[model samples]
Target: MPGFAAHSWSACGYSVQKVYEWLLGSQQRVTWQPFVWNRLSLPKHNFLAWLFGKKRCLTQDRLIKFGVITDGIYYLCGAQQETQAHLFFDCCYSQRCAHLLQHWLGVYWQGDCVYWVIKWRCKSLCKKMIVMAAISGLLYCIWEARNKCKANMVMKRPEAVIEHVQAAIRWRLQRSDFVQQKDSTIAWIRDKRLS
Candidate 1:
């Protein structure tokens, strides 16, 4: 299982050796410890610039079309100005979702968007994949939820969104081999720490 995890991580541009250390939870823990625990634990170097090999959405480009600058407002959040940073990281609604994730992970919530995604460290390959999927799923769901809330389809609650993310993670993990081995690994990790 660890072997397969290594292969997956390497394929994703991560260092297999570093991943081994991370899986053992022996890596230097990042002090930022935002809303999600261990989601952003990897050093800056390990971060993939593109999410799942897809281009990142640039907010500055969107602003030109929205013409919010001429109108004295931001389109995404209806703020006085629109920028990529504001659209992804600084938006009020997104901040709430980020906060919810931080609380769920039992960690502090920092405001670094790119760093938030880059620092994740998972001991096992399967768990690492699951965590990545959960992060993406959470971000997607929040975006959709925010749009729905803005349109009056429903109200947005960060907790509820987080619940959706957890459900999504469970659904994905059930089909994979990771969950089958979690009980043993948990015990092993615990024992390793004690020794």
Candidate 2:
């Protein structure tokens, strides 16, 4: 067995491969960062919160220690359980965001997870990457907006967040090489009259 010092990194969820990457001076992105220090199943939830500066600036833990459940019954909208999945994907507010995304993509997303639809249905790698970025941005914005609501800040409406998510996705798509071409092709196909 290895010495205590050598084994300590793994205690914090650092794999040998991740440590090697860090030692090799890899540029840090959210996807490449170390796992969080909590035992929470939704590690991605922490990542999304951190990425968008949610629960970062404030001393929320102090408030939490005073016996407060910040997300009691979901402050976003009166939904079921206030879980990360519900807030991010299944909530009424989140479903509105998802509907905006669906309309923007011109496709129906049947699955629950964002990555599944992007990987399985996105026709091209570029579109898939764009969708992944869109998902990230939407999740980040939702967290930020949720935090604002928690702190009683001037927050935009949930519908506005859905519009923002759609706009961001469209902006990314516009920067892609094939978005215009794909749009033109679809329009042409749709507009053609039957003989």
Q: Per-model C-alpha lDDT, please?
A: 0.51, 0.54
Identify the candidate with maximal TM-score.
2
- Give per-residue CA lDDT, model 1, range 19-120, as digits (tens): 687668755664333323333222221232233123344334464666743443444456646454564557786677767665554345366643554475
Clashes of each: 10, 0
Residue pair clashes in candidate 2: none
Candidate 1's clash total is: 10
TM-score result, candidate 1:
0.51
TM of each candidate vs. truth: 0.51, 0.53
lDDT of 2 by residue, 51-155 (tens): 433324232433455576454455677556455666677777877776676665555666564545324554554545445555566676677777787679565
Model 1 lDDT on a 0 to 1 scale = 0.51
Best by lDDT: 2
Worst 10 residues of 2 by lDDT: 32-41
Residue 136 of model 2: what lDDT? 63
